[model samples]
Target: MTEPNGTTPSSDDDQIRKILETLLADDEDITARAVARLHPSIKAASSITRSESRSRLLAEYQQRQADYRRWRRRVAKRSGADTATSLADKDVRIAELEATVQLLTASHLAMLRAIGELGGFSKWAKFYEHHREARDRLAGFGAIPTAPVSSMPAEQGGKKIKR
Candidate 1:
């Protein structure tokens, strides 16, 4: 096309303009159609190149899919093992806590019973005094002496005792 200055556009400009117009068109699917039509050699080479590229991309995609599958399996196995280990550890910890609770409960009940036995402050003081006196007496006397009580089998209908 001639410019307003009366200058004619070059062949290169016309070719570039046509390619640009083709690009701006709605059908972007036509890759180098104009060039392929101008040069038959390039048309064959472009087709071969496109075919090789498509095959290479497909192979890479398949490899990546396989790798992803392996990775997913490994992740799932690790997560499952972690979950199982956590559950086992939790069970052990819970058992340990239950045992501790039982011990604490028994100790608490014993303390409550001991406190209940003391009816009042005076009774508590007397109880302490009685135990203290008995302990001191025992200490002074050394080991406690056992008393023997005799029961005659002839006095009652009873089983015979083996001495």
Candidate 2:
């Protein structure tokens, strides 16, 4: 807004600059020390006491702080020990599982060997016969007859396909 004769208003920058300059000029009532230390707690139970009494209180505070640190260290050590025990238990369980797996694998290999000795099951002649029989039962429904096992070339692996 303009003044009566159209003069623009003056800015308040000068006033702000003066205020900042005054504030930046250091004086009393301003110190780097903490305000809490300057004016301590005024509670009746914790009022400012003689230096001797304050020394005792300070020592007690320090002792408590030290005790808390010791407790924390003990807790950390105990947790580490517990973790070590858990790891040992896991190792034992893994060893037991490994033994069980070894036995199971041996048993499986033995069973397969036994089956191999009992005619190896290399040919599906018996299974084909049974499937043909079922298909014969379902005849007239477009069931196509397949060549019998006997029609196949004999002497496959020196074994006869039984009827």
Candidate 3:
């Protein structure tokens, strides 16, 4: 149907074409309106580009943080392994020292027993004096002393007794 302007709805395309032709005939006003219409679209495109750039920067920062965390974990693991190895080495050394102490203790005990069996410190002193005397006598006369009577032993009560 034709409106009061006498242009039918079916003639919308023709009417728009005519308006565009008239605007083009006078370039200034239509250019201003076209610029106005495009302003928002240009701003929207720039905003989308800025959002994409921000997302890319955030992704890069996250990747760097992940790399740093991985590096820290690796260092911690290495330090832990080193600590374990050091503790193991210390245990081995302590065991070796303990074995050495055991050996020394056994040797010391054997020496004490031997000293006790040889008539103790006072008896050993007396024996040494007699030994020196016998050596002096032999050097002077070219003759050794006979064995002492008390040194002779006999079995008695499941033990030996010196005469």
Give me the candidate number with maximum lDDT.
3
- C-alpha lDDT score of every prediction, in listed order: 0.49, 0.44, 0.49
Tell me the TM-score of model 1: 0.26
Q: How do all models score by TM-score? A: 0.26, 0.28, 0.29
Return the lDDT, model 3, position 103.
Answer: 78
Candidate 3: lDDT over CA atoms?
0.49
Ranking by lDDT: 3, 1, 2
List where candidate 1 sits over 4 angstroms from the true fold. 1-78, 120-163
* Model 3 per-residue lDDT at 136: 65
lDDT comparison, 1 vs 2, better candidate: 1
Across 68-103, the per-residue lDDT of candidate 2 in tens digits comes to 666667667777878679779999999999788667
lDDT of 1 by residue, 39-74 (tens): 323334243235454334334444655666666576
Count clashes in each candidate, considering only residues at least 3 apart in sequence or on different chains: 0, 0, 0
Looking at model 2, the pairs that clash are none
